[model samples]
Target: MPTKTKAKSLPDGQLDHHAINEFKDVPIRATIEENKKIMEELFKDSSDIVLREFDIENGPKAMLCYVDGMVTTSAVDDALKALMILEGNAFSIDRITEQTLPVTQASKIQFYKELLTNLLSGDSVLFVDEQDTAVCLGLRGGIRRSVSEPETETVVRGPREGFNEHLRTNTSLLRSKIKSPRLKLKSFVIGTETNTNVVLAYMAGIVNPKLLEEAEKRISRIHIDGVLESGYIEEFIQDQGYSPFPQVQTTERPDTVAAGLLEGRIAIMVDGTPFALLAPFGFWQWLQASEDYYERFMATTLLRWLRLGSLFVALLAPAIYIAVSTFHPEMIPTNLLLSIAASREAIPFPAVVEALIMELSFEALREAGVRLPKIVGQAVSILGALVVGQAAVQAGIVSAAMVIVVSMTGIASFTLPRYNAAIAIRMLRFPIMILASIFGLLGIIIGVMVVVGHLAKLTTFGIPYLAPVTPVDMSDMKDVMVRAPWWKMKKRPKYMGTSNVRRQRPEPEQ
Candidate 1:
């Protein structure tokens, strides 16, 4: 029969305080037994939680506990064979104490808190009946999707590997690229109920200590029931809670995270989520791509400019069309104005309404393309756009000029490298369009000023959101407006607060 204890009476604060203090001194053996007792009490309905028992000759009987589906049968069999069948001498818990245990095959865990943590992490725990300690073997297994290319960040010229849900695998991928001692990874557990593992990765010497500390404190203060994804942590810790723009950038590529870390930024990886967060993000960083670094500088610079130009078109093209056709007819060339006026003459709604209708329809079609199955999605999006645009013009519901404007804006928005930044631009288009309808070109200018003002004021963990642009750092501008050759990028971005500024040595001629 299993032993049971009644709940101890205490205030909530006092209970937590006592639990923390009690956990500091609880013996490993007692803690394991208590955890088993608690788990049995809490998970009484769970039949898959298994506990296996075995004995060491002339020593205490030991028990191993693990979730059935979470552990591999082959590994368990090998461990059992090594501990029970193949041993030349009688197995003894006293002989395999913390100091004497082999680190090569099995990891030795001493503290009670660590033992409990390991057990909860899906590893099988070995508990000696009469001993005061337990051994935790590092063998965790669970069902997970195999490594595949990132769905959101598909690239034409780069490594196709993407991050998996496993924290170790994600960290390993980063480690594989940056084989430097300066790389540091700090792990913590968040969420009282879920106890999700969160890792903070950065270069020790490059990252700003103050910024790192602030990020750590903010995350530590998140007292919640669970953290299902990196977005949960992002929402809880964002500098500007009301802003639609994302302060922290998330990516599924380990290469991206590793590059960010090397540049004095920090990465946050949460358990059970493939998306990882990178902090101290700037507006221009969203326009950059890993492919940019791999390609020639001239090609990369041209692509960067193209993306920037596309961003403007995405945000203001439709609004400008509505304003020029309705209010600022003088801004358009005589021939173009005549063509637009002729097209609008047949449409029932005003230019503003026509633009809105076409934009909304385009957005709806884009969304449908995403939610639908892959085999049919691309075909639907292509055919839907062409069919709908042509039909809307023929029906006189929307002008041909408005269709062209909306299509241009949609294509422009697709050039953004970061999805979150692209989404912010997409959302801003509607408000600007409304403003254009009311105050014409003046309203559009005011909207742009307001957005620029907000961006100038915004800070990502104390780093300027529009760094090296508003501040005008000539040295860092090389990487922002153009992709400088690897040899020319002599220093890291000054705003990053890196201890070592120079990336390469001065030439002998200099």
Candidate 2:
């Protein structure tokens, strides 16, 4: 005999528990009805929830359960029509079992847990009364952005379709790209209250077991109540808790994720977020873009170097200016120095004060441009920069040379691939500028050394943040400083813990 207990505190107040002894040696047909009764009890209070009850004529009566708005109506309708109208004439329980349902025009999916998992995933479940099993029909729906190019990662050449919020759709997009059986996806639910789904994707046999284990362990330790975005999980699971630089990179492009997986990096996909996280990221990783892979190797390499140069200019240009004007006058050309002195002769503020004022104003204008509506933002930024620069110079509050230097520095910082990394540079600029104004070139060197020391201490998933450079891997440098030809990139990134090193066969001598 089976004992059932009703749940009082649950939302439905109908959750039922059956003693294991009652189900022992029981027929599957009997077990299914018992399971249905339990589910009915569990979901009683969810009135909007839909559960379709139908029969296979002379065979068995069954039910389909799904959340109202989470499933496609058309899909469920078609499935019901197929079961009731198409197969209604033939009503044998054996005809509709998992083994026979596909032949009888219904998709047959086995495994009890899989059925429950699919049902909970917004798919309609078909429960045949006489049979002990159920079939979960794949029909998911929810409000999601239409397929469009990613705003953050716009490409002049390449696939423009970005990942959408829908997890299944995103998985499908990835699957469509890499049809190999080597591609593996493992799912876990995080968050005690939210129960948000987190998926780990990679190429099995290629990915290092150690890396996978570490990633899994970190994710499992997350004790948060909610995981609303991929970033939430990233922050919780990143190796270093103090570094401002991002240890995990996020991308909206399926191609990027697929490429990363092929190279043995783990891709984490959170349920509600379109952005996926990739771990074991390096400082230089932020500087590379998907466009780099799409364009010619030479063009890509040149653009990368240009970005690197721009980064230096962004970080060091203002400090250099302050140092030269305050203490290093000899480093400046005699004519340029004379001209700079002539302009500064009328300025009321010191070199540091002028630099601070201009930099702060530039940052404020940039923020305004970002927050303002798209139609007016560009115009506002351009006009604001021109008016502020001209007014300050004309008022004798700042030198014309200072305005040019600050403007150039601002523009240089904008060239960075990652916005966060750019902001980090922007923040460090002020301290370096102040130090340079106080101690000239010596202060600048001290600031650089401090920044480098901090970077050396930083780690991303146990791998040094400045890997291949600080550690100095000659082979990895082929891809880091320059965009190597695809063939030359035969091995996976050493930091990512990929078991399989080679991606392709080596070229034979011609």
Candidate 3:
């Protein structure tokens, strides 16, 4: 037995003013006029809402309601034309859905909230005169950017296709790479007002179930008004909140996402954004790049060493220069020490002060360049750094040695493959420089120790932040320190969500 819906007699566009109790349990009514009035009220200020009223020759009267920019008008016209020419004395929901309409997704709506939501979410709702239920036609259409190589994560030799703003499009890109039933995507609608779709993707057998559960649990607890980016989801669900380092990695490349999936990591994709979050990330991964695996293992391994040296220079070069020049001059050779002394004799500021001035000026110039238009930004950054450094040296504001060290450190920071990881190193340089100014070399040691301890304590969703090295997983070092030949590497990193540990089994050579 079903309860009949009583039509509410209210003025148009008055649903918002009504008390919550008035429509607490209201459902779709048998009267089409009341439903139309309710929908019009909900979408009163929206001029883009299209309500197309039509009649069947020998059947029930119906009206189509949808947002303008969300759906294709031609598809709606085709479906409406097919329904109007149907040969029937009465309208049957099943018959109309099966034969009359060419729509692929037509869902029946019984509740008022469901009706309104479907209408707002790019689906056209067909309200009938006598029916107690409405039909939701899937006709979403809008201007979306086509998939192309991401400007941020572009590689020399890899798939150029990248994730677009559409969630379905992003999922399809991943699915095209790994065509297996094991790949699973579980969706959850988050955000109270936005109702943003957040999806968790991973391989069913390869991904650890516990890791999946933890990720799902954290995301479910996020109750908010909206989620504008994948970063919002990352902030809410990351393992550490106070840590400066990014516990979760974000990438625009589908190949990177696919590789993360194949390695038994979970990727979180937020609707309306292209950047996806890959979880259980490690510290070593920050130093690696997409091209590392694309090239020869030996060449990749050497590049990894270069990146490691660059990271060191980016963080400690300025601080070390100040320390050695101010407190450890004995460590320098006689000729170099005499040369540095001669350079700094006419400088107005001490080594620490000079370094700080140059670093701050460089940072300001870097920010200015980034905010400017792309065409002029790179030229501005390069010219600004060069002109400022050279002028400051000639004016005796900063020594030439200081300029050289600052320039070298700036160049080293750009060596990093990912910008997010480079940010952490960049932020730490200032603090280390301050310590060197106060306590000299010992202060630098203390600062380094504190940062190392913080990183050791940090975790990316329960996996050790400093894994394979601190815990000494020698097998994992093949890909971490040096990119071991793919054939030589047989097992996946342990306790990091890899289930099918065997990646490839090479035949033994005699």
Candidate 4:
């Protein structure tokens, strides 16, 4: 897709709008020299591209062109050996492809651009002297990252295997969990220069037709220079493109994706990225984890409440502390207020400034921990927080009460299952803290109103971002605010509009 970046646009500023070039329209020449001329011109100064010309026994002159490290050398050697030993009197593309190739996958490519796409994707192309088409051998093999347990979405009692960067492997992982024949995996080529492979996985009958169409339409509308990862695809297809809250759910765990698909959601998987994007997702889904489904329902139910509480604390702890300590001292208990006032006796900054200073410093230390080496990052975050909080308090820059509030808030944030959700709450803290300083508890109320309004207004592909709660679905309350027992969860999410609504049969007698 070298033409991706250079693709000429129409007068209205649309991509791929130019007339087809004569080069792509040109058929492979009967003579080997003419074809070789075009090939050499296309790959002018490339050193890694290998082009081998040889005589085929009882066949026309032939050439094999492919990238160096993409294909196995021994496979190519064996293919040559097999081609040369054949005693056929005539060259036929079908016969050659069906009989001679030692590999499993092969196809006849007709156009120049198609051949280029295949060769670039790590397949070897065999060009016969007088044939107008080329044989594409599936020889893609090289070093790839091995599949292992995902570091971020780890679970104690579920499948430990996580998705790797390979597209086929990820799809296979989904299929293994969902053994139904209706599971569909469709491919789309995105990014002009990278030509990355993106797959859309969904169940045919279970997925909503309108939702699937919308997702596919959004993906087709993206004509970027390159798509290096699934994040690239995620941004392109998300509903609220500018919203801080994630409209798309990202997960590296295979079980998570499989669960989403079973509930009638479509997944987008990009090559060279372990993370996959799930569509038509809601905010509550982020609070749910893989372990929630695997663990006992009672335990998961309790954990959900803890996560919900943590989310509020992460977002409002600092703001509330500032309001209560500064302008609403009567709201606090007398003893706590005295303790907070004593701690702030020598501090020179106002409540808002004090909170912001500590919050920003803690956030910086956290970022340093993440950006540093893993072993060093853990030590830096832990020790940096301890040292900075203690030193700031002793130096009389911040109160001990403020330090405790910030620490508790940080702990609450880490309790979130999804990093993206936690990040949204984390980033929103500063604005609310400023609001708290300006108007005390009233400012906090205004900020909460604004956030709730935005959340209610937001939608992910026509499904409410704050689904079940905002739409006020009475039946969905079982799973949204709390985890219902396995047998109690008798139907799929109402928004899915799936044909088969019953998720399971009635529970049998004990």
Candidate 5:
């Protein structure tokens, strides 16, 4: 059972505590008044809790306990109407649930822990005057956002539907994609106070047993007070703590989660959050887009290469500028060198300092835009960059050449499909920029080497981070470097260690 440790002081200066041990093993009392008093004590400060006391016709007394606005009022009324007009005097909880109440999803609860769980989960519980057991009705209701296109991962030639905050809705979306009995969604209740519902989704036969076991072990080890989002689970279950690169991929699209499951990856979904976590993520996947599988292989391959190029530009553009202008000016062509020199003539700051100022400003503006309303954000980010860059150049605070470099870098970062991957690159850019300032091009080279080495050493759930590329698995490269045509790509990733390697049988001769 879950635990709650917080203590609230009563009006008489006594500590009113609901510790786990106090009620974790406590069973319901036979008297309705006793049960009602215990429940009232547990929910003292809560005003939304409703304890509607009513009498059954020719039968014993009963009380309905539920949170207002959380349960269906019509259903609760119908249940009361049915119970109040009962024909017999029998008043057992089992008899009322099985033969009397009109509620279809009613179940008997014996302990307070189960009672509290069902009550908080938008269900209505009933307490009879002489019964120890209570009936719990599934009447979950309240306002929830409808499904819509994901804000972070918008695609043109794919399913427009995205996962909503509702856990059942998200699971249904995945079920719609991969309609197979083998697709299993095992549930777990985590967090002591929140009791957040988490599901581990995977293709039963395709996922390796060891990988699944490890994933479960890691997740089950998380002992926390509450979990509000899937990111909380992601942080706890990831293999490496300090790695900037995300070991588990987060996506708001159900199709993406389904795709990962088909490839022998496990997806972790948390309640009250739309984002799902995909484990055993690879380096190349950072550049991969969901649209890749929907379009022609050739076009998708070209787009992948474009994103790869942008990744380099975002990572190296500013550092290259800093290195060349500060130390390798001779490497520049005569005309371009003269133009750059003239642009920086009145600028007081060096190339490195100028680049830092522009980059930091751009980052600040991007963050501000994201935090603000959508309509206003776009305008602020776009106009802020243009106005600030031009003003800095005109005021001789930074060179025009530096502005172009910073703008290019910012644009390149935007091209990355994954937000977390883009953030990692953006963060690394500063260190590389500082290195270039101190040791010129050699420092940039050293920084790049260190990054590459760290990535090579990283792993996601025992699978190498740079799979297929670093380990040189040729069969898996079809989807890495270039997404091979669907028919031609006949096998799942070998690195996943799945027994079912064949995604499709070979095509017959033309």
Candidate 6:
């Protein structure tokens, strides 16, 4: 016989166990009343649990247990009606699962842990008198956001469909694109309390076995209380936590995840979050966008170069301005120097102070625009920047030249393809600006070297963060420095260590 110990209470006078570990492995009871008592004890003071008791027609007593609003009540009612009207005199959980349950998805569960897991995941569990096992019916339903274009990662010429919070829906979206038996989504239950389901998606034959094993090891090592989003998993499993560059690339777009999977990379998706994570990410990927692959290679190459220009501007524009105005004025053109000097003559703060005030204000306004309602966010951000910049210029708090520089820098930052990458650049800007103010151009050089050194040292799942660049792989450069036309590109990325290297057959020689 299993023993029941008194559970301790918390300061708030609630049970502290929370069904974490104490009752997980307990076997289902042969007696219905005893099982009901245990469930009632587990869910004490909870209003959402629904345990409906009924008798099968000419058979044993039975009950349906589910969380209200999670399982579809109409489906549950239909299943119950079917069970009540059964004509057979002999009945068992297996018999009902095989013949009676109208639901398409149903399974038999024997342990309390399995029962709780199913019930909590929106399945209806049918328990019968004298039966030690319960049938878990697939009746999960509730209001969920319909799949729509992602707000974060929009593309002009690529597929607009994005991942939603529903885990099954996301997997189906990926499946529809790949349509191959080789594509596998292995599931794992994480989060001790939330019991969040996480799926590791990869192409079986193409992905390196060692990479897959390493990914699994990292995921299994995570022991969090709950995982509310994919971000939680990214932070836990990534190779470097403190690096500004994202070791794990996050995407809300299914096509992006599909692209990553096809390249012999693996993706991690969590339940209840639209964002999914891709591993073994490289620096060049941050500069590339989904639209880059959709358009002509020539156009994509030009745009990539443009983004490269913007990246440098976003990262070093303000620092350069501070360096030039404060220490290297002689390096500037004579006429341009006079104009810049004239603009800042009446400014009350040093060039660095001027840049900080404007940069911080710009960042704050950008954040406010994002958090506010979309209708007014743009208007407010634009109007706020205009008002603040014009007023500061008029009051001599900052120079007109500084206003122009900061505005251009902010615009440049927006051109980068990835939001997190833009954030990293934005964050690095301030320190670089301070460096410029102190040791002038040399400080800026030092900062750049430090950042580069960090990038060279970083790795994601054992793949170099700056792959095909630091450790040059000429074969992979076709997709990096330039987007080679589809015909010329005949192989997947070499850094991923995939076994299946060939992506397409050689272009027919004219």
Of 1 and 2, the candidate ranking higher by TM-score: 1
Over 4 Å off in model 2, which ranges? Answer: 1-48, 51-64, 82-120, 125-135, 495-497, 507-510
lDDT of 4 at 154: 85
Q: Kindly list the per-residue Cα lDDT of model 4 for residues 288-404, writing each as its tens digit.
A: 999999898889989999999999999999999999888999998999888888989999999889898999999999899889999899999989888878999999999999999
Candidate 4 off by > 4 Å: 1-24, 87-91, 506-510
Candidate 6: worst 10 consecutive residues by lDDT? 6-15
Candidate 2, 1-510: lDDT as tens digits: 874543222356343333222222332334456657656754669886777778645455678788888877877776666666544355654455443333223455444444544566676777776556566666777567887888778889999999888777788889998999999889987764456788999889888888888999998888776778998998888877776677888889999998888878889998888898887787888678888888889999999999999998999998999998889788889999899999999998998899999999999999999999999999999998998789989999999999999999999987887776788899899999988998999999999999999999888878888987988788788778699988678887776667888888777889
lDDT of 2 at 505: 78
Model 5 pairs in collision: none
Which regions of candidate 5 are displaced past 4 Å? 1-22, 87-92, 506-510
Instruction: Summarize candidate 3's per-residue lDDT along 84-168 as a digit string, tens digits.
Output: 9886546688777666788999888787666665666688998889998888899988778899988888788878888989898
Compared with the true structure, model 5 gives a TM-score of 0.95
Q: What TM-score, computed on C-alpha atoms, does each candidate reach? A: 0.91, 0.82, 0.93, 0.93, 0.95, 0.95
Candidate 2 or 1, higher lDDT: 1
- Looking at model 1, residue 199 earns an lDDT score of 93
- Per-model CA lDDT versus the true structure: 0.81, 0.79, 0.85, 0.86, 0.89, 0.89
Better of 4 and 6 by lDDT: 6
Q: C-alpha displacement of 90 in model 6, angstroms?
A: 2.7
lDDT of 1 by residue, 181-276 (tens): 889889988875677899999898788888889989998899887788999999887899888788999999988998888788899999888999
Candidate achieving the largest TM-score = 6
RMSD of 5: 3.0
Q: Residues 1-510, candidate 5: write the lDDT tens digits.
A: 876555443467443555433445677878887777777777889999999999988778889999998888888888989889877666666678788888778899887878887788789998888888888988887778999999899998998999888898999999999999999999988887888889999899999999999999998899888899998998999889999998989999988998999999999999999899998987899989888899999999998999999999999999999999999999999999999999999999988899999999989999999999998999998889888778888999999899899889988998988899999999999999999999999999999999999999999999999998989988888999798998888889999998699999777899
Give per-model CA RMSD.
4.4, 5.4, 4.0, 4.2, 3.0, 3.3
List of clashing residue pairs for candidate 1: none
Off by over 4 Å in 3: 1-13, 16-26, 88-90, 505-510
Q: Considering TM-score, where higher is better, how would the candidates rank from best to worst?
A: 6, 5, 4, 3, 1, 2
TM-score for candidate 4, residues paired by index: 0.93
Q: How many clashes would you count in candidate 4?
A: 0
